[model samples]
Target: MSWDLSFMFDDLLPALLVGLQYTVLSTVLGYLIALLLGLLIAVVRRVRVVGPVAHGIMEFIRTTPLLIQLVFVFTLVPPTVTPLTVGVVVLGVHYAAYTAEVYRSGIEGVAKGQWEAARALSLPLRRTWGAIVLPQAIRKVIPALGNYLIAMFKDTPLLFAIGVTEMLMMAQRVGQPAGRVMEAYTLVGIMFLLVSIPSAILIRRLERRYAAV
Candidate 1:
C-alpha cells in the first residue's frame, strides 16, 4: 500500500505524541533516579566492609537483561503500583548499575593531588568529597550522563513489555487494527530520530567542550 501521509500526521501522530510524552517523562524521571542512586552506589562501593558486596550487586544488575528486570519488578512490587511506575523505577535501578561505573570513573578522573590537597588541608571527609571531589567529577561526567539520558530515551520503547504503552506500542496500536503498518511505524522511527540525532550531536559537542577544559 502507498504511504498515508494524512493518516500518519493525523491519527498516528497524536497517539505517538501522547506516548512520546510518557517516553520523555520516564527517561527524565528514570535518569534523575539513576543519577542519585548511582552516586550513592559509587560512594557506598568505596566502603571497606560492604564494598565487595555492593560491587557484586552492581555487576549482577548490569549483566541482567533490562526487560527481565522490568518484568521482575512488575511481579515483585505490589499490585497497586502501575506498570509505568514499575517501568520508571526499573529503568532507573537498571541504569544505576551502569551509571555507578560512570560516576566511579569520573571520581577516579579527579586528580590524586586534589585528594592529597584535601588531606593536607585537614578537611573533614564529607566536606572533602562535597566541596572538592564531586563537583569536579560531576562536571567531567555530564556528557556521559547525557548520553545515558538518550539511551534511556531509546529504551523507553521497551516499557511496552510491561504494558506501559510507549511510542512503539502506540505505533502498533495505531497501525495493527487499521490493517496498515508502514505509516505509523515509520512515523515512530522518525520521531525517535528527530529527538535522538540532535541530542547525540549536542552531547558530542558537550563532550568536546568538556575535553577542552
Candidate 2:
C-alpha cells in the first residue's frame, strides 16, 4: 500500500501523541518506584543473612522476561488495579532488580578506607550511610539511572501487551482501522527515536562529566 503521509500527520501522529501521555506517566512513575525500591533492596542486601534471599529474588527478577512479570502481576493483583497502574508498578519492579545491582556497584565503588574512616570516627551507622555512602554512590550512578529511564521509556510500548494504550498501541489502533498500519507504526518508531536519542546524548554528557569526577 502507498505511504499515507497525510493520514500519518493528521491521524496517527495525533493518536500517538495522546498515548504518549500515558507512556510518559508510566515511565516517570515507574522510575520513581525503581529509584526508591532499588535503593531499599540494595541496603537490604547488605545484611549477610538476608542478603542471599534478596540476591536470589533479584536474580529471579532479572532473569525473567518482563512481559511475563507484567502478566503475572496483572493476574495476581485485585481487579480494581488499573492496567496503567499495573504497567507503572511492574515496570518499576522489573527495573528495580537492575537498579539494585547498579546501586550495589556504586556502593562497592566507595573506597574501603572511607568505611574504615567512618568506623574510626565512630560515626553512627545511619549517619555513615547517609552522609558518606549513599550520596557518593548515587551521584556516581546517576548517569546509569538516566540510561535506565530512557530504556523504560522505550519499553513503555510493551505496556500495550497488558492493555495500557501506550504510543505504539494507539498507533496500531489508528492504522488497523483502515488496514494501513505502516504509517502508524512508522510514526511510533520515529517518535521514540526523537525522544530517546536526545535523552541518550544528554546521558552520555553526564556520564562523561561523572567520569571526569
Candidate 3:
C-alpha cells in the first residue's frame, strides 16, 4: 500500500503545529530560566563562602536521572496540592542545574587577573560582574551554551511522559491509527533538523564573532 503525504498535510498538520508550538515555548522559557539561574550558580561556586553549597547542589543534580525527577514533580508532588506549574518548574530547575556547571566552567576559564583588576578598582560586586567578568565569560562560552540549548530543545519531547503533549507526542497521535509510523516519525525528525540545524550554524557564527573580539 502507498503512503499518502496529502492525508498527513491535510489532517495531521494541525495537531503537529500545536505540539510544535508547545515544544518551542517550553524550550525558550526553559532556556531563559537556565541562563539566569546557571550564571548565579556559577557565581556562587566561584565564591569560597558558598563553594560547599554549590558543590553539593551540583553533585545532586548531576547524579540524578532527569526522568525520575520528572516523575516526582508530575506525579507524586501533585498529591500535596501543588499545581503542574510546580512540575514544569521542576523541569526547568533540573536542567538549570546542569547548565550551571557549563557556566561555572566558562567563568573559571577567565583569567584571574581580570577579577583582580576589578577588585583593584574597588567596584561594587554587581558592577564588577556586570561590567567586566560576565561579559568576558559569557562571550567565551556562547558556543557551549548554544550546544546546551539544542540539547534542552530536544529534551522537550520527554514532557510527553508527564502529559505535556509535545512534538513527539503529536507524531505518535498522527501515526498510531493511520499506521504510518515511519512517515509521521520521519516528518518530526525533519522538522527538528530544520529548526535545530540553522540555530546551530548561527551559534557557530556567534562563537567565531566573539572569539575574534
Whichever of 2 and 3 has more lDDT, that candidate is 2
Per-residue alpha-carbon lDDT of candidate 1 for residues 3-96, written as tens digits (9 for 90 to 100)? 8788888888999999999999999999999999999999998899988999999999999999889988888988899998999999999999
lDDT of 2: 0.92
For all predicted structures, in order, the TM-scores are 0.97, 0.97, 0.89
Please give the distance, in angstroms, between residue 194's alpha carbon in candidate 2 and its true position after superposition.
0.7
**What is the descending TM-score order?**
2, 1, 3
- Residue 58 in candidate 1, Cα distance off native in Å: 0.8
**Candidate 1 positional error at 54, Å:** 1.1
Candidate 3 per-residue lDDT, tens place, 82-169, comes to 3335435666777778778877777777899988998998999999888887888887888888888898888877787777778888
Best by lDDT: 2
Minimum summed lDDT over a 10-residue window in model 1 is located at: 1-10
Off by over 4 Å in 1: none
Model 2, C-alpha of 59: deviation from truth (Å): 0.4
Alpha-carbon shift of residue 75 in model 1 (angstroms): 1.5
Query: Please, what are the lDDT tens digits per residue for candidate 2 over residues 95-172?
Result: 999999999999999999999999999999999999999999999999999999998998898899889999988988
